[model samples]
Target: MSGDAVQIPDDRAFINFKNECNSEEGWNSNCNKSGITIWIQILRRGESIA
Candidate 1:
């Protein structure tokens, strides 16, 4: 499949999804950490900081 066809959603969608995730109990301590870590890795990669 083409990369465009598998593009990530916009920022608003990512925010909405993160908020929905935060509403779940225990999600903040576990899944959220992993999510933030992954996001940080992505940002670092984009910035060539990794």
Candidate 2:
């Protein structure tokens, strides 16, 4: 997501609803594969979102 802001999506379902899409390339577990969930944070100038 190389833009002003990228939607990290509510889940992997939105970006990949394709039934035949692969696991890493797509959400093959119906968004149920739990792990380290990384999220995007939006910050203004001089803001810390880490």
Candidate 3:
């Protein structure tokens, strides 16, 4: 898996990881006190992988 992160305006940030099939699985951190939220995206059978 490969991962990257970026920060945007308004105290927002995003982090992501790409798997072998280009499916993304990662998290989002909005600079909040609570914490971050994680996510996963499974690629479809015919989806393009790049």
lDDT for each candidate structure = 0.52, 0.47, 0.44
When sorted by lDDT, best at the front, the candidate numbers are 1, 2, 3
RMSD of each: 11.8, 13.5, 13.3
- The lowest-lDDT stretch of 10 consecutive residues in candidate 3 is 11-20
TM-scores for every candidate against the unseen true structure: 0.33, 0.20, 0.23
Pick by TM-score: 1 or 2, better one: 1
Q: Which candidate is the best by TM-score?
A: 1
* Model 1 Cα lDDT, one tens digit per residue, 1-50: 65565667999999988986566333223234534632222333446531
What value of lDDT does candidate 1 attain over all alpha carbons? 0.52
Runs in model 3 deviating more than 4 A are 1-34
Stronger candidate by TM-score (2 vs 3)? 3
> Model 1 segments beyond 4 Å from truth?
1-4, 25-50
Judging by lDDT against the true structure, name the best candidate.
1
lDDT of 2 by residue, 1-50 (tens): 66687656565666565533333432223333357444334457997733
What range of 10 consecutive residues in model 2 has the weakest lDDT sum?
24-33
